[model samples]
Target: MSRMILRALLCLPVLVAALAAAPSPARADALHVGLVIPQSGQFRLLGDHVREAFQVWDADNPGAFGDIVEGDDGCTPESGVDAAAAMIEAGVDIVVGFLCTESLAAALPILSNEKIPVMTLTVRADIIGEEAARLGWSFFRLAPRAGSEAEIAADAIYRFWADKPFALIEDGAISGRELVEAVRTRLEERSLKPNFVDNYRPGQATQPSLVRRLKAAGVSRVFVGGDRSDLAVIAAEAEHQGVALSFMGGDALHAPEGELPLPDGTMAVLASGVVPGPEAEAARQAFAAHDMIAEGLRIPAYAAAEIIGAAANRSDYGQTNLVDLLTGTPFSTALGPVTFDATGERQEPGFVLAILEDGKFRRLSVDDASRLTGESQ
Candidate 1:
């Protein structure tokens, strides 16, 4: 009897070893994440930056958690839906990316139905506050809302140039209209009305007539709601026409200092959720070790990776409860302490006012414009 029992026990150990070597049930540890971006098209530059940022994060923290499934959305709704479906088939835990608002709107239904969370890098405010709520909790944004920055810009203008006449030039896009409206509302709240408000088509060949109108209006301070390219062109034209207006620009102006050319004494402000400083520099160094540059949408992408890493690290390793960790837990990133509100917006301040001096954007105090724009401080 003892010999028979010994043989049975030996057989049990072999059976267990065989089972362990074979396939097991899939769990959260095997889950992957999908990164959907415009890897090919007009927005490719932004997408490459985001990709490089994630690559750097993954390299710095091996086996941190989740595999990245790449999907090219091409900045279109149709492509975004296709990408989301592919990610679902691949069993990704979350979907991140979509630098364009239209693409985000296109992918929303699929991700919401699948209960997959998305962290958009775009700053379109209406999409998150209105669309996401109507759709579901599966949507979140790390980028600052559009209206918030506009409001901040208006406040800066009001506080700085209370005595000077101001003008607004918008590109007539959705973002442009929103910015113009928000700034208008903010100015109204302070009983300040702009001297002129006009919408111009972006990328138009000749803005000479527009410049002439602006000069005729006697507009001194100009608020531009457009991308860097359009803003630069307008600035050049304004300079040529000898319009001595102090320009204020959106976060799009926060490109590498010399990337855009502006006239001497052209002061501008940049509104963004994250400001590149010491913490950003440290993160950049870490990213460079893996041959990556942190810029554009890359900062938010890196922030998302950091947030995920923090959540995974805090949980018992290999555990399956990700939603709980992400929703309830707070994480500290190179940007700052990050905590998502119920709506998935990062509960933090937005906008870092910058000044154009000596052909570079220097971080300035909120009141710096008033002192600089004034005849005598």
Candidate 2:
């Protein structure tokens, strides 16, 4: 564990991170990490996953942190403020957890007063990013920025349907409209105009008219800036019409499927959350020992602990030095190398391309995308 901690901090080659290091007389006087996550609200389950992962990692690393002060984010502004106050009272050096954006937003100013740096596993709103840049808050995220989904959606469309004629469509919801507009703007900048661009009245049982229009446009592929339910309807309607139209959608594609599940070939570009692979072997073994699967927010939360251990080991480590080290240097973790950008967003948060096959979104690769989207006519 000590050697692994050292390798995680690739930038600080000369320093050996004290995570899981040999016990010493002063070992109890180590850094205290404050954990603030939703404990009594709709998002409680999310917070639980994060906390469980943190505990597993802490156990694996043993003497990595002096103490862990736990608090509830409450998943609301008032509760968030209370949680932050608890952290300050506990005199913690750094903070982790904070899955709720509202909770984190309300808590940041209080933490900023004490110059405490924060490490979030899953708060990825653009407003949080704007506030960080505007207020100069010391925040580091293991998640992508909000608009990353639209950018990734556009890139995936180009890769899969650049040669094949494809249409861009959206439901009238704000999220759907914005995603469609962003994708259209990006494609136009690259001189790739869609065969059709339109909005459909959402929440209908069927979309025969929309599917007819898609067939009329001679498009074999379509990108939907809408929810999974709406996409499911369109895909079903197209199949009913024998149009053979393939569909790609944004994060909303993962929503719970009602009676109509999305067609098998439907693809979605979802935000990069915790996609633990072979790099997470050690973490996986640790999780398995506890009878837990290394998945979901657990992976990233464990990665957060790794970042804290490695970053805290610097000779001149302090709250103020966190942002500099996190943004400028890369740290290896269960989720590959975690490097942040100026806005505290993960720089290389690659989107997950999932295909709705066998009633689930399976991770997809480029070769699989080609086969699923019917390979451009």
- Model 1's number of clashes is 0
What's the true lDDT of residue 181 in model 1?
A: 86
Q: At residue 143, give the lDDT of candidate 1.
A: 71
Count clashing residue pairs per candidate: 0, 0
Q: Write the per-residue lDDT of candidate 2 for residues 1-377, one digit (tens) a residue.
A: 58787676774643445543645533223578898987776877778778888789878777768888899887788987898899999999888878878888988888978878777777767788788879988777777666787788888887778898899999988888988999999988889899999899999999989888999999988999888888888888987899988789988776677888888867888754433456778888888999998766777788788887776665555534565666767888877787888867777754677777788776686679667457654
- The prediction achieving the highest lDDT against the true structure is 2
Which regions of candidate 1 are displaced past 4 Å?
A: 1-31, 123-125, 171-174, 199-219, 227-243, 252-260, 264-275, 316-321, 328-330, 365-377
The superposed Cα distance between candidate 1 and the true structure at residue 28, in angstroms, equals 11
Least accurate 10 contiguous residues by lDDT in model 2: 20-29
- Looking at candidate 2, what is the lDDT of residue 199? 91
RMSD of each: 9.0, 8.2
Q: What's model 1's lDDT at 40? A: 75
Which residue pairs collide, candidate 2?
A: none
Compared with the true structure, all predictions reach lDDT values of 0.73, 0.79
